[model samples]
Target: MSKDFTYTINSIFFDENYRPSDGTRITTNFANLARGESRRENLRNALRMIDSRFNALANWDNIKRDRYSVELEIISVDIDIEGNGQHFPSIEMLKTNIIDHKAHKRIEGIVGNNFSSYVRDYDFSVLLLDHNKDLGAFSVPDGFGDLHGKLFKDFIASDSYQEKFNKSPVICLSVSDNKTYYRSENYHPVLGVEYLPNESSLTEQYFKKMGFEVRYFMPPNSVAPLAFYFFGDLLSDYTNIELIGTISTMETFQKIYRPEIYNANAVAGNHYRPDLKHPDYSLTQIVYDREERSQLAIKQGKFAEEYFIKPYRSVLEHWSENSAL
Candidate 1:
């Protein structure tokens, strides 16, 4: 571990086309910044949040001791489901790389991108056709209800997405269920570990058949449950090294800085949505009462010391030993 690793932050590697190499583990917060008031301001705030958090990581000591700086790049691609010449707005697809300045080695898996349930936001527009206007109040047609599902499936399986990463991507997403173990007193959420049983998640089953090894992880105090789709063995290398640290760090960062978005009851509204019945989407429970959901978040965060950090202690320790000079 004598060699130093250079970390680059917010650097973009893709061209105007937004296509990546094969097997690249693409990570994003799914237009988290792109959605709000000012795109520039949101991006600035997002980067600042990450920068401050990275500097706050316990492993590094000071500026002089800071061997791990990050390079981050934000990119997006447009998928035209319509054959018309009109193009949709650019989708945000970001890339991150951690470099070792001393050894000149580049680390790919340190930061995995995340996307929220926003697939419907962008792709849903494409599915809304003039012919299907009378389908329902949601404006989604009959057989086309799976339009979002099909688009998501095709995107991941598409050459554009596969080629973007040097390795298969680990797609992480959220799930909600009242009967799920996390809701039970006997069970609690843990980050970086699988949560859903194979039969429980439709999204998980879909990805698994597409050659992805699906594993789910939900952080303590997390508003929604998450599923991690490992395209190959990508999770193994990442978890053994930077993945744990990154997840924990982001957990703390979001709670402190983005409480409204990251809080435990944050996703309660999703349960009641009419779209939940769509086959293209995973099933979820609507928790209308704030009190119950808040209690769940509290309990979820309570066992952090016992369940998450402690269990992954060795992985964190191992990463610390090898990631530094």
Candidate 2:
């Protein structure tokens, strides 16, 4: 087996002129939003959702008035396989910078775990089903997310990422609804109530493939807890302000993605699940198009199958059989 892999990063190949050099179809929420006559309105509504969530999270210091806000920018990452020079959109994330109204200062920014790729399908759709299992532990065959994980690590380790951002990534995901949570004494002022899951879920195991361990922290003023995935000390890797940038930005996306939980109007609890059809369910700020999200995942999976999986199946098999993370 060939023990060599190479790629290049093209961070500037997105936005209005996002045509991939190799005819690679980029599937992202932003890409979908950019496609129609209502592109402006779509983006505008997204901004409002983020602003509203940031305000809610920063309400602690807003007793008198709004004391904080978040500024966000879309960052796109494209990769050219084997150094072929054909850029393919790989992932997209948000660079969130906090605005301290009281201090009138713009704090340093952080790369938040935002919507981007097909991996979301494995976590949200595939693993979510595992949550409903009445009698089984979460599991997947070894090397399940190995290729995806490696590709992700490569992007983060690339010069383009280090030179531009120079910061570790922080991924935030929704807690499994079917599992019970126990509040621990572990807590941070910026990262709110810490909850321990009863047991590991498939989602946790999946992220571990990409060098991200999970921490469940329900930030102040949040209705429920969130699972934060990171490579280093969740407490020490970044300052409180940077962590706030992550919490505020990702919490907004979570609320939009899984409002049945984030907007449930409740705190961390054991075995809590929201009834979407129930009258008590709160009306979400924006109606997320679940079909769009899921279909994009399908398209991305097909893309990977055609371009990477089939051609390199034997190579991937060799690597997986002999290597372990």
lDDT of each: 0.40, 0.64
How well is each residue in 31-126 modelled by candidate 2, as lDDT tens digits?
554445655555566666666666665566677536776676666666555555655556667677777888899886678566465444443444
Q: Give the TM-score of candidate 2.
A: 0.77
After the best TM-score superposition of candidate 2, give how far the Cα of residue 133 lies from its true spot, in angstroms: 17
**What TM-score do all the candidates reach, one by one?**
0.46, 0.77
Task: Please list the residue runs of candidate 1 whose C-alpha ends up more than 4 Å from where it truly belongs after superposition.
Answer: 1-45, 51-65, 80-91, 101-106, 110-112, 116-119, 122-153, 157-159, 174-179, 183-214, 218-226, 237-325
Candidate 2 regions with alpha-carbon error over 4 angstroms: 1-39, 55-64, 100-105, 118-139, 270-279, 312-325
The alpha-carbon deviation from the true structure for residue 126 of candidate 2, after best TM-score superposition, in angstroms, is 10
lDDT of 1 by residue, 209-253 (tens): 445575545444345444555655644445432443344334433
C-alpha-based local distance difference test score of model 2: 0.64
User: Each candidate: RMSD to true structure?
Assistant: 17.2, 5.0
